[model samples]
Target chain A: MDSIFAIPLISAIVSIAGNLAVFRKASFLIAGVAHSALAGVALAIFLASISIELDYFLVATLFAIFFALLATTFSKFSDIDTGIGVSFALAMAIAVILISLTRGYTAKLWAFLFGELFLMTEKDFLYISIALVAILLIFGFFYDKLIFFLFDPEGAEASGINTRLIDAIVVAIVAIAVVAVIRAVGAILAYSIFVAPSAVAKKFSKSVAQSLIYSFLITLICLILGLIVSSAIPISASAISAFIASIIYLLVAIEKS
Target chain B: MAIEAKDLSYSYGKTIALENLSFKIDDGEIIAILGPNGAGKTTLLKCILGLLRANGEISVLGRDPRKDKKVLNMISYVPQRSSLSIDLPIKVLDVLKMTCKEIDSEILRHLELENKLDLLFRELSGGFQQRVLIARALMKRPKVLLLDEPFNGVDVLSQKRIVEVLERSGATTLVVVHNINPVLHAVHRVMLLNKKLVAFGKANEVFRRENMVKVYGAEIPLVVCEEGVVHPLYGDQHG
Candidate 1:
């Protein structure tokens, strides 16, 4: 039980870091790729693992590396015909069905879906803190390259910008982040923390730099509030944060329109 | 260095798009590529742009366009108007604006589209969309402007306006025009293509009735009756 919990919880920790990335205008595909990989592992454990080992940090590290590799590879083919959107959606669907079929053996499946961030534990929180620092450093270093790609991919490529390499690296981050978030909010909802804040922030900014700045600030606020709300009110941290994010996006959209 | 193509050839699958095409575009000279339907005119431009692969050495501004980003950045391309996505929620000004260090109002005024920046690109007429694209290309301040069938579905007035803009762009402009009359006097050099180099020289010298008959597969009849002399029925059938 602890091992199963370990995989998702550590993933949720990384999810926070990846979610931080969306503030810098990373593509939604990265988040999806990351979530899909975690969902694959969670689905596997739900069906086969009779005993849980949530304390295995090495298992989390291996999953991060594996998911990151998949993400990097997928971004290169993101331009291909229907491979990005179609295949990923189908994979997510298959994961849902497999989890549903295994429902009789493990009611903890639903717990994984909603996440138990309230139980992120002192150790998991420490891991999350370290992951956030790493994410911040990476984001700071590659901020210019990432911003340029989003605005004009063709122009950037024509200018001989190494967009393909940047794209692949972003994928790696997404895969790792999705795994991190899986422990708290599950696979499907992890995307909310990743994409919503940035998308909402874009409604107000004129420049890409401004958009990224606001997106990160918004994400940080949501995380702090989500953690606090879930603690005080006995609700899922992910759900509370997601609800707040959705409302903020709605208000931003409505205010602009 | 002047752009030159020697024994240049290209193909798309089994069908031949260009065969042994050869010509030289002198420095600072505007050359208009003239042809009818299926004339392989675009293939030649694509070769120059390095969008399509070809046999034989083709040099643009002395550098291979395929491997040269500096050339690509220096060369302005006005792709076919229809190739652009119309309903992308992008604004006219948004498309026109680029990595140019400075944004000047004079460029928009010259194109006579100074006031329509915020309008959605899809909402603009076909002519306006073409102008917007031109503005985008001009944003780079390129030395060579390459246009592929830019006048398609455009009005005569817009055609004249576009021609005037390109002339004033202070660049060696190359245009692909299907009809000759609108651009015959406007263009300096003409490269007639029908899967190969039919003719390449001065517009008036190369676009004569004899050359048109040879390349277009139709002879324009001139009938002198009583007190009147009738020229080719459809004006200038070839350019």
Candidate 2:
């Protein structure tokens, strides 16, 4: 029952925040940070067995933020994609090592790997809701400035917009959003929902507001439809949702071409 | 002086982009900066705008652009059209909205962009895109305006409109152009640069064969029109 409500809610939040990331050209950066978040989660689980207490969400958020800053620093001297690729690889390796070091949490960790929506408790939903609210507030307050920066960075800087600060804030927000949703949908499916809707919306909409609306609607529809289809045919909801999103993107590409 | 630079210099690691350059512009004068690719034309503009930190002193409107960010309220910049993200889903109106709280419809009508407000920026032709950029700059009612490669990819008609707008702007304008023939008549003076200040004076006085050779490393053919205006015949060398 909670899965029914949680999937659509999380999807809505990811679409809006994800589309903003798309505008900033930080989609892959989100992926890299999301992977780093996994290492943080695994480390927390491993530490708990040694009788050391650390909040997994706090550690994951910190790890993702660190990866975000690292990727940004790497991007300064090289292509952004290359920086993100390196961060992604390093984080994945660390996560595997940490997972190997842990014991008797295989079932719990596996649920995080592919996302078990049915396992979400009320507390999980509340935490994600707080993240959604934070994303909305930050984006809403800085919408015009962010749009100006994304449109023309040099112009924004000349206008005294503090573009570097804006860049840092944007990547940090994406990092937070990725960490919040990674466990709910897993890394792979999180990326699909984060990018696919915005990519499709960019083709269909003529304005930023229109694009945001379209992206949100597309994600919500995919999540709800995935749920309905999974109920009839015993399939994983996250897999079905991601598959539907990909199919929509492919169809959009073919039609546009 | 609307802008002044004293021995301004900048280097990117080992490569010196600008070297010991000093010049000044009177208020409301339209000066065109001419230089070949990598001649530090854009870098000079960035220095004046305080986007890049330089070794020497620079001032705009009696304020150090790097030290006093309040100067930004009285200045505007229109970067090259190519610098913009080509696929953003932003409308002409959206770009204007970012500049100020209210859109000056008068500026829109002047640029002939009022009707095109609903169109996405990427959907517009190159000419219209340049106009929109200029229009966005003008909306701030700046005391100083800097434009980089405004003529690139623009049609002849849009170029004319751009010149007209700049003429009426009454701001201290510094425009960087590759082919100065199009804007030669509109500019009050020409500041030729090739990593260093080559010449800064009236176009006729500055376009001497030696000046052309010194900056461009070649003898650029010069033509004198009926009005005795000197026009340098050279292909556009934008990068």
Interface root mean square deviation per prediction:
5.4, 0.9
Residue B39 CA displacement from its true place in model 1, Å: 8.0
* TM agreement with the true structure for every prediction: 0.62, 0.96
Q: What is the DockQ of each candidate?
A: 0.12, 0.82
- In terms of lDDT, the poorest run of 10 residues in model 1 chain A is A1-10
> Lowest summed-lDDT stretch of 10 residues in model 2 chain B?
B230-239
**lDDT tens per residue, model 2, B1-239:** 99999999999889999999999999999999999999999999999988899989998999998899899999999999877886889888888877876888888888899899989888999999999999999989999999999999899999999999999989999999998877889889999999999999999999999999999999898888788999787754322
Write model 2 residue lDDT over A18-132, tens digit each, in one string: 7777887777876787788887888788888788989777888888888778887888889888888888788789889888888888666665666655457777777678878
Total backbone collisions for each predicted model? 17, 0
Query: Who wins the DockQ comparison?
Result: 2
- Identify the candidate with maximal lDDT: 2
